[model samples]
Target: MLISMKIVIISSLFPPNSYGGAEQIACAEAEKLAREGNKVIVLTLKFDKGYACSTSDAKNLQIIEVSHKNIFNYYNIGKKSICLRFIWHIIDTFNFRLANDIAEILKRESPDIVTCHNIKGLSLLTPLKIKKLKIKNYAVVHDVSFYTPSGLIEWGKEKSWEHMGVLTRIYRFFTRRLMSYPEKIFFPSRWLLDFYYKNGFFINQEKLYKPNELGFVCENKSVDSGGKVANNFLYVGKIEHHKGILLLLDAFERLKPTNVTLDIIGNGVLMSEVKKHAQTNPNIKIHGQISREKLPEFYRNAKAVIVPSVVYENAPNVVYEALSCGVPVIVARIGGACEPIIEGKNGYIFNPGDVDDLVEKMKKYL
Candidate 1:
């Protein structure tokens, strides 16, 4: 006999809040699971404008929005400091009130399994509360940066990192104590899992799952290729230093391919620099933050999509979105970006941060 289970997905961001890739994946997964005949529900933070909280069975899914103002909105060096991090952690510990509220919902719903995606905006206190309640829980780590507080302290902005020093060290020391509470830990990439294992963060590798292998489904249908006329190469993602946006711009400047253009989507702190580069160079066009509905059009019209992220991204939705549109990708050889691309087959790869190699690769595509 087969038994059906009810799943409660906890995330910090959800649809209508779509801040990054983690939000998109959580939305997609919840919808998919709901369609699969399992009762699915999502709990996410509420935006300032507020979100609609009601039962929508249209997609066989239930979306529950819990309202909470995000304290960490923009990058504040003071707030991100080690002393601040500790203070924030102490304050966040009181977020057990929010977790207890979530626990009440879980008890009322009586879900068989509690699955959590990104909860950076929410609180880790919720999971611990749920575990104490004796609920079967799974926490999915989208990125390794959050596992240890030191990871954030090291990789975050210099000012923030400096502020986070001693407090972050303390947090890192106690991370294992908090982390070991989770019954199951889900990692999107083998590379991430191995990295954590090597770092002694995660001992049991069996808990990690490579869900990216299943591939993502694109909601928009692929546009007919015959009518598309643009010869532009697309790069869709946040314009951060870690994303290697500057590297891409440098490479594109070096190539200087006549009649070819580069369309950059999304906005970030480095927007001014990127804009300055675009102003001097006529070939680069910056389209800041396009809606998900409009992304298909960008992918379809592009000659190819470029993913030049320098950091080890677990699995970027942009790559999946591009491939789903049948648009070939030219991604950096580092991280999980190279997982989908078969070199010359569906896409191409170049050395991370190598402007010359990237320029050569761009020229070949042009």
Candidate 2:
């Protein structure tokens, strides 16, 4: 029998406070680790208003929410100069306070292994801190944040990811050096692994693991629908510009599929645009944020789930969720989102940011 070990999950955000793919994936892994008889403790940055340090409990998970000097949690960060943002990241590159907090937590609850995830608010200095304790550690690369300040590089149209400027190169060099602190590294997609390897990341790391913690056995799906639901499509992910919300809106408007209605179920920077389009067009509806527990019901009844991400996705949990409910998927052919989907069977893959192609696919539903 496999032994259950004590595991610490460190991520930028956790469930109930998550708004992106990485956080939700972290939450799933933490919960799964707990259910498998391992002790799981989640040390995540808290982003809610008026929250200091707090503790909470889930079925088999222990959550420690740490408040920090973050751009997301504080409004003052909005007014600061762009240089200041760089400074904030630099400070956290080996943040003294962040290390101390983790050290203190370690004293109280020692873990066998620490798994790291998106550390934007937590800091890139996180793995180094764990190294000091001499514990087995590995980081899950959900984005390019470890190598670049913005985590996202310019892609689309005629642009692909390229080398950064002098300052950015310097920033990435130091972070990439620090990136080697972990004993091992984990990737959710081969594309992410390739990105890091081609750029000389974790060259000296002990081992590498991929498709991390994304596979799950879906529960029996049952949702309360007053009557038979028809021709309803679902979009359950971030509403950012990079997620292609605007493209989806354009497609829905131009095509004007009378037999179909789109249910958008997430929040992000582009929420206003989603709402604006919804107001003018009755076919689009914004449900804002909904609990994960209730999402399967939406998926169970939907004709298909749309993942119109413009950027390369490591692997989207929503895509898996949709498939688990026996719902078909309509995803962009970028990175790992297209991996799980078998075209014309469970889903269709379209060119990234192609509104007309998306519309043509939607027309098939009617």
Best by lDDT: 2
Write model 2 residue lDDT over 170-263, tens digit each, in one string: 8878888888898888887777787788888888886454664443344333233665555687898878877888888888788777767889
lDDT of 1 at 86: 55
Per-residue accuracy of model 1 over 1-366 as CA lDDT, tens digit each:
122668889887777666667777777778768777777889877665655543335355777766443344212322376666655555544466667778788889888888888766466577777788888888887775454443222223435543356755565455545556668888877766776666566565247665553333443333335764558889999888888899899888888788888899998889999999989988899999887778887887777789887766777888888888777888887766678888777788998778898887787666
Q: After aligning candidate 1 to the native by TM-score, how far in Å is the CA of 217 from where it should be?
A: 6.8
Off by over 4 Å in 2: 1-4, 46-60, 67-81, 157-163, 206-209, 212-229
Q: Please estimate how well model 2 matches the true structure, expressed as its whole-model Cα lDDT.
A: 0.75
Return the clash pairs for model 2, or none: none
Q: Model 1, which residues run further than 4 Å from truth?
A: 1-3, 53-59, 67-86, 148-166, 213-230
Query: lDDT of all the models against the reference?
Result: 0.71, 0.75
Per-candidate RMSD, Å: 4.2, 3.5
Give the Å error, residue 40, model 1. 1.7
Give me the overall lDDT of model 1. Answer: 0.71
The model with the greatest TM-score is: 2
Candidate 2: C-alpha RMSD after superposition: 3.5
Provide the TM-score for each candidate, comma-separated. 0.84, 0.86
